[model samples]
Target chain A: MSAAASSRSGARFWTWLSVLVLAVLCLVWIYPFLWLVSASFKDPLEIFSKGLSLVPNALRWDNYVRAWATAGFSTYMLNTVLVTVGTVLLVIFHTSLTGYVLGRYNFIGRKLVIGVLVATFIIPAGFAIIPIVDLTKTLGLLNNRWGIILALAGSGHAASILLYAGFFSQLPKELEEAAVVDGAGFFTIFGRIMLPLAGPVTATVAVLTFLAAWNSFLIPLVLTFGAPGQRTLAVGMLAFVGTNETDWPGMAAAATLSLVPVIVFFFFVQRFFVEGVAGAIKA
Target chain B: MSLSHSAIRPSIRRRLWADRWIYLFLLPTVVLVASYTIWPMFASIWFSLLDWNGFERAGRFIAFGNYAEIFADRLFWNAFANTVIFVVVAVPIRVGLALLLAVVLNAGLPFSRSFRTAIFLPVVTTAAILGVVMRFVLDPASGPVNEVLLQLHLITQPINFLGRAGLSLYTAIGVWVWKWLGITLIYWMAALQTIPADLYDAARIDGAGRWQRFRYITVPLLTPFTIIITLITVVEATNVFDLMLTLTNGGPFFSSEVIDIFVYRQAFAANIPRLGYASAAALLFGVCVMAVIAAQIVVVARLRRRVAEQ
Candidate 1:
């Protein structure tokens, strides 16, 4: 858009310069992951051997073998998957259902429910860990997968419910009215009309919830303290790092294994991930 | 029964019965959520009054003794101070750098999408594991950072990044920012998009330079969003124990301890395990949290009113 040829060239130069700078910075930002991956593949003795380049001297599978065996990565991965999938499923079901009814119908005590949920959503649940532990014990749920699932999923999902509620509010009433006109009950309307159309928020809730449940540490640590079979990835990784502190290649392999699933998930769902993040933030 | 009383009671009962469908949908959620959230809230208060370890059931009730002990503890205060310093130092840098990146990325440069995704990788990963992985990446002897510096002949001796006294906490903050900056950038991006292009175009029509447009036009419109983002950051920062737990273990010499670590160590890591004192510390932690919620209500309420007025 510059009038003069020299100024146009200058503008072009600035744009290229900015792009070049940003690209370099992104490389820097990504360096840790690259190095982690490379280090994991390197021979244990050669990981620190003369390299700014990301290539390993020999692409060995030994670290992975060592990490998987030592960290009990298979069991940890299985436990994490069970808990994450279970929690995500429950959260989606509960939040979507709660959001629809609370967002739609003006029934008795609805205002009170909304008020209480909103008030409590902002508080950090870590403060209540002690009682939660006691509550789990009373319910005979300690060291159980269901206990961890319920603990993560059920409590303090007010934020997600609120997201769904806001979304439902903006949806046109004509759909619900037509459904009612066609003799649909609340359940049918919710199932056939609302939930079907809640793709964006559902995707948002799914990704965010999955990420949180997958990555959670402290609660899972408390709930499954001595239960080796029940340990999530984060806690398992911690123990792996703890025991394998000086074993750089093995630790790197463990970290890489733990990170791979989420990275892959994000890779495929990049569009939805971006939309989910921005959408939830805006809501 | 009298006719009038019988009639009124049935109407009230039927009205309630009609709304059972709503309650049916809400039943499992309310039970699960309220039992967890509401019950534990009251439970924490009660727990704070006792002197029981994690294993014991019967314990002496020392009504305000836990709070009294916390008040007298120097470590608790040190933790509190360290947290405040971390927030005071780290948050501004994070927020500023995020805004700058967001503005630059919003310029719609070639390959901006790839750049954004590359930066966002860390956000998808857990912060605690980053702490674990980073220990290797920043290790004084074997870390790439040291290796690169040595090759460049920048330093004769490797820097003790995470093991030093004063530098360890800053290292923690640096790592925290690296993981979190992407999310903040996304927030800023969402906010920036809400500012209309015509305003920028109008400023340009008036012969305003890039800096001038950013100064007079952009800054004014971004104030509300800035407040919201700052409050959210502060709220999130208070709960950052796991990073210190995994990263520094609040160490080199307990130099990186935050309030949450103090509480966690008390409840879980202590010899006798002072669950009561931990509860008390958590209650104080709850105060910091309450301030966060209060800020949210005020800003959100004001923003809503402003939107309505507009």
Candidate 2:
């Protein structure tokens, strides 16, 4: 073959290869999700009974109905929603405030404060889990939604602050200078000018925080173990598994229900979310 | 006092007073962080000194007893070994696979967006529940994989992927790699994008082969990302408690019990819970994680200085 023909064939081979690789990647990534849905519809007793074609014996809504009722998914979901919302709000408010001030002002101990926040990531706050539990108990926060919310909100300080601060630093000083000239005080400028303009970072932190709070398990497990009624969906599913052992259909349905909300939210904001998280890492 | 010195004192005081709003803005975060994050961190070290079962309000101070116990406990060492093995085996593979995937997807593959989303689905979705769901996939009996294996005559009997003592930790790590691979891929893509394309073009023009270009340019340009990615991996890997809890529960005769599982078991799972000992294990684990991160920070800081100097 001529050199040009060989190069063309090589290019063609790569195109087909990429297509094949991407197709397989998509399949493998999606298979578990598909299996989850299929098993959710299977009969609890009849799951995998037909030799594992990943097909349900029938499309039974019973598992979902049963899981929703038996496992008290409604309460878990409510608890999760409360914790997640509170965490996102608190984190955004606190970190955005901190980031804005740190970004705009040259202040004493600013470097120390930033260093501490960043160091928290390295130190891994988990060493303090026991003390945190005791502190929560002392503060009467254990088994309370507020306990989990406050704890989670206090975490993720470094990344969120950095992301917000990056946004804050990039804003033209003229905008803030105009606001300062308008007799707007700190909170005023922050609320009206800074926070409004920090939409992208806020959205990024909110989505990330929301997903984290929603999916957290061990925190709720440790804090709310004594108060089973207050369990989040993640911890509730653990208990559900303990009780409904081998109830594959019901378990799968429970898992699916827990994941669906986040999955949907992720799909909508994914393009932005990926860019946001990657962007934060760069900062 | 000299005129300039005296004048500067008042200005400093005025600056401090005028910046009260900065303080106020930072007050909630400072107070919340101090109470919830900082306090607990210091408190853990104190807790590690006591001989307590965790339920009681107070306990005797047996200085260094918990740490001594941690050092001596066979299970602790087993867990330490297991965790080290996990980091050694899992982190590189996860980061490596992610780089490969990100490189391919960065080439503008067909359906790149959906592919990124699909792979990243596991990261954002309820991971613990996904672990529980994965149990179904890896179920020895009535699992699709087993059925396929049987159909293909790969094995005579259903293999217990999660139940087997040897395979449990590695299996869990496999799941870990799969779950978090997308985030790493995203990071790699972001880092790769920062490198101008013309460098590659220039290299090609200079008669540099693809391997030479990638070796000299891509690898050098990727150092900061590699450092950051490794840092993220270390942090993420050490925090795999919930997944472990749901996946194997550190089971099959404790073959898979990493330090996180070890800590949980001592604090919560054991019939004779030793909270102090658990704290010691956690402290050690935290120190190790911090040491790794501190090293990475030095590298990252050096990289930053080099970039700045350049």
Give the candidate number with the greatest DockQ. Answer: 2
Tell me, per candidate, how large a share of the native contacts it keeps.
Answer: 0.69, 0.70
- How accurate locally is residue B219 in candidate 2, as Cα lDDT from 0 to 100? 88
- The window of 10 residues in a row where model 1 chain B has the poorest summed lDDT is B1-10
What digit string (tens of lDDT, one per residue) describes model 1 on residues B1-310? 1111244445656756877777888887898877788888887888889897988875579999988888899989988888888888888988999999999899888998898998899999977889898887888988998888888899999998899989999999998888888889998898899899999998889999989998998888998788778877887778787788889888887788988888889988888888888988988878876885787778789887998899
What would the per-residue lDDT of candidate 2 be over residues B1-310, giving only the tens digit for each residue? Answer: 1111244445666766767788888898898888777887888888889899876788779999888877789999999888888888889999999988887787776778778877888888887897888887888887776777888899999989999999999999998988888888889989999989999999989999867987999889998788878877877887888888899999889999988889989888889778888888898888887787778778778879998999
Candidate 1: the clashing residue pairs are: none
lDDT tens digits by residue: candidate 1, A54-79: 88878889889987876698788899
What TM-score does each of the candidates earn?
0.93, 0.94
- Give the TM-score, chain B only, in order for the candidates: 0.91, 0.89
Model 2 residue runs over 4 Å out of place are B1-15, B205-209, B296-310
